[model samples]
Target: TVKPPVETVEVSPPETPLIPPEKERAPSEKVTPPLEVEERKEVEKQKEEEIEVEVSREEKEEEGKGELKRRPEEALERKAPERRFSIKTIFSPLTTITESIRKRKRRTTALEEVGPPLVKPKRVPRTLKEELPPADWRVLKEYEVRGGVAMIRIYLDPETSNYIYWVIEPPLSDVEKDNLKRLKDLLQVSLPYSLEAVEEERREKFLLEHLDKVMEDYRIKMSENSLEKVRYYIVRDFLGFNKIDPIMHDPHVEDISCDGPGIPIYLYHRDYGSIKTNVAFPTDEELDGFVVSLAQKCRKTISVANPILDATLPNGSRLNATYGREVTTRGSSFTIRKFREEPLTVVDLVENNTMSADMAAHFWLAVQYGESMIFAGGTASGKTSTMNAISIFIPPSSKIISIEDTREVNLPHENWIAGITRGGAEAERPGDIGMYDLLRAALRQRPEYVIVGEVRGKETMTMFQAMATGHTTYSTMHADSVKSIVYRLENPPIGIPRVLIQALNLVAIHKQLKVKEKRVRRITELVEIIDIEPTTLEIVTNQVFRWNPRTDTFVYGGHSNLYEKIMDMEDLSRDEVLEERDRRAEIISWMVKNGVRKFWDVARVVGEYYEDPHRTLSIIEKNPEVEGNPLEVFERAAEKGRKEHLKAKSVAA
Candidate 1:
């Protein structure tokens, strides 16, 4: 039968196209819209030859019974073009369909949908064992089950908090303990070396080397529970600390302390102050073994004769342990003050509201101009972090010499000399280099800046002498307030003449506070030392900044004495110095706005700023994506610098 001419359908273009706004438009200008517009024209031209198709009643019925994943081809043609389908690309889905003569196959078939509603193969959940830490703690990873109780690691979740706490694992059942003993014996012959002898690099390799063979040989017929316990035991013993590996990985834990056996482990969390964990040793023997293993990892011997042990771990965390209750009264115990490889930056301090942008700006001016500053605070008050953050302001080219009991100060400057003190029984030869020795050596190196980790003993005298000779000194001291700083310096052991105290120009006291349940660290007092009072022998201090707890803000203490001193030394006016301060502040503010908080990244930016201040500042000024004052941050800083420059020239006349 002859059919009257078939009519083609004209499709409309979407209101919005799929192409990027500028990249597609920039080249041809009119090329983007033509695809949508021309496709309609092409379809309408072929309308006289177009043919329509029909579906059978049986097929339609089957499709209706099951859920349809895709719409009809006509509907697909309508929606697909609006999204990803680019008309120009010859290989596009729409292009393939429109170009082909054969009928398109349906994505979902009727037989396929009806054939046993597909069982979604269940996802194998992560076996709920503890996470394997990246470090090795092999001192006593493997154990034989002599008693009924076997230590099984279980992950704990505090019902009130989102944090997953790994507590002292609950004891295993009698049957489970027997399984662990059998598993240990099966794997015992294969182990090449003890945990202590296995190097850090070889620990992971050793565990993994034997893992597959052990599983294939022993894990084939084992139950999931028995298999899981064996795996946890293997990992806990080889790769991580039996009970505290999870705590070792926790970034929030500042300090981890174990007070002998049978007592709860205490942790000084950065935000929570002191939190007693659920993990503790059941026996003194177990505790002693762990402590000895830890000491071996630190490469130190802890004995009854040498009960007081202080050493550094492989990861650079500080370790202090006391054995035999000779001094600590508790059995062998340890307290590790976790070390941060990456130091805190100025941006971190500002974003946390520890210090204001202006106060930080003032600090920048002071640091650049060789101001001797000291961070004073109580224990765990963020004094070192504050000092480390602020030290970034020191000219990147300046030669810095850092002396510490144990290596701590990490600087980005290439011109840095690090000196660490060594003593105790190890100094039996009478030639162990102490902090005093390092300080004296640092001076002969002719460093522009001297950083003492902390001034405790005779080293205090040497540090003060360095400060007196125009070397910009930065140190941390254990003191509550600015007055206490003078007292500590003038007293015996540290015994500095009261007249020499004026050498210290800045004392920034950081404090740990509890505003509402949460622990916050902030600088409560920032003082500028005017001079030592000749008449009273008391320190003449001008309060430059004080933290306001009520508003959670920093109140600027008038203008700035340190800033004035900087201007005088640099031979610039008040306005010029203010401009310089603002300029430095804006650079820091820009960094905070962006996420340049890492020590190396922050140092890189600071180094670039030193190379070309205007270029660096302009790059920040032009980027609209970065958040800050924008007009105020740049214009005010630039204007102030220019004005100050003019004032300096006018005064020069």
Candidate 2:
């Protein structure tokens, strides 16, 4: 360590430097370069000489031509080059840009060299005259106009020329004819013009000849299988081979029901709803064959053993047929119910005067309040139609179970379960699952409402039991009045006791009346079940409302005992009850004003009001004008009068 210290060396600090600005340069130093100065002077001299030459030339030319003289500087300045262009030249740049873009796109889309290119086989060209055989062809039919095209139907025998069979020719122009010939040549087909084609008068003769040939050929084929007469009838009548009836094109004939072979056919027309058709079969065999044809169209079969067949036609109309005397007492009978494009609605019923607006409203309230009801009517009395219309009154949020023997109920509700019963087959022992089975199952679902399409068996007992056990139910029965309904229910298969019958809140009797020569369904009576009389095993009828056929109006006879019992249970005073009734009527009137003419529409509104009576009452009070009708003033005054009357009665109490 001591030796290293002796060899130590010293280092000096770095020296500082300074820079000078151009303003501090020496007085003798030059700042400009000689070459640059000389170049500027030469450029100025050249510009001046060029200006003087131009001025002299301009002055001489101006003096010679007697035009205005220009200044030396202005004369020397060159004018901008003038641009002149043709249309093509103006678009030349754009065209080039477009071509370049197209070329680039083409290059990008070109296939890559993945493999060798495919070569297609070359097609050979052949002349029509060489391939076709010599045969006498005839024009079957021809329709033409002077300046317009003509349509020609031609028939050719395949044995004579297999390449050319039938031809539908339209008159062609010179250019089109040439094109057609070229087409015929390319296809190696014949373009022979028959004598009848040129002769318009002879076309009909040829047509008849071809028709006879076709008919003879068809008869031969059909006769081999014993179907000649059947085929003839089909071609002559149904298919309209010669002439078709205009009525066949009508859509409203839902069904064509025929009881016997020689009987007239009854058509279920859509407008003028049902009528008897003029057509009839001469014999049972003919009718049986027709029914088989109808069944075949429905993709079903009919036989001697299974003579009775129920099937849906291609057009969705339901067809029922009975072959021979097996199913029918007389002969082969058939019925067809045409599918409705638009099903009947409550509004439709109201508009058709099927029921009064108040009756519809009452049904709405009844359905909304969960009152069990039965629509009693005879056949064609619109029992199912009335049920369908009433079903729309079910609350949208409720769970509904509907049992039907057929698919008839068309409800708009979302939370609904629809069940249809199956009929027993002839082969094996019939299943026990009938309407009663479905009705019983429906009760297990804990439904808010149960609907039976139509009661005809023991199912009525179960339905009545369900009604008695706190389930709101609706059903239709084949009867014309309350007494008939009770008699039917208390009798055979549906044997429900009179006590159980009292569970029903209302019986709406629908009757089919011939009003103005038109069949109309009318709710003749709406009877309430008051109680079961001890004297007779029959239910007491409290007629709440009745329809006057003479006046075409519905009349309220007296207070419904059911409603009075409900009022009494609620402990409401007489005045309060009257006020509530008036309120209900006002709500119904409000509904009518708002275009609520259907039972279902009324039911929905009433159901909503039932859920929150106070809110509905307040709405009515606040908006005296609902849907632009000021009924609130009258309602408010009536409400005030009722309140005052209630106070006076309370003081008396």
Model 1 pairs whose backbones collide:
8-47, 141-237
After TM-score superposition, what is the CA distance of residue 315 in candidate 2 from its true location, in Å? 7.5
Root mean square deviation (Cα) for candidate 2 = 34.2
What tens-digit string does per-residue lDDT give for candidate 2 at 419-497?
A: 8665521113366357777888888899999988778776777888899998999888888888788788889876877
Candidate 1 C-alpha lDDT tens digits along 414-515:
898887777631244376777777788889998998998888787888787788999999999999998788888889778988777788889999888887
TM-scores for the candidates: 0.67, 0.52
Best model per TM-score:
1
List where candidate 2 sits over 4 angstroms from the true fold: 1-255, 260-263, 268-274, 279-301, 310-319, 424-432, 565-653
Top-scoring candidate (lDDT): 1
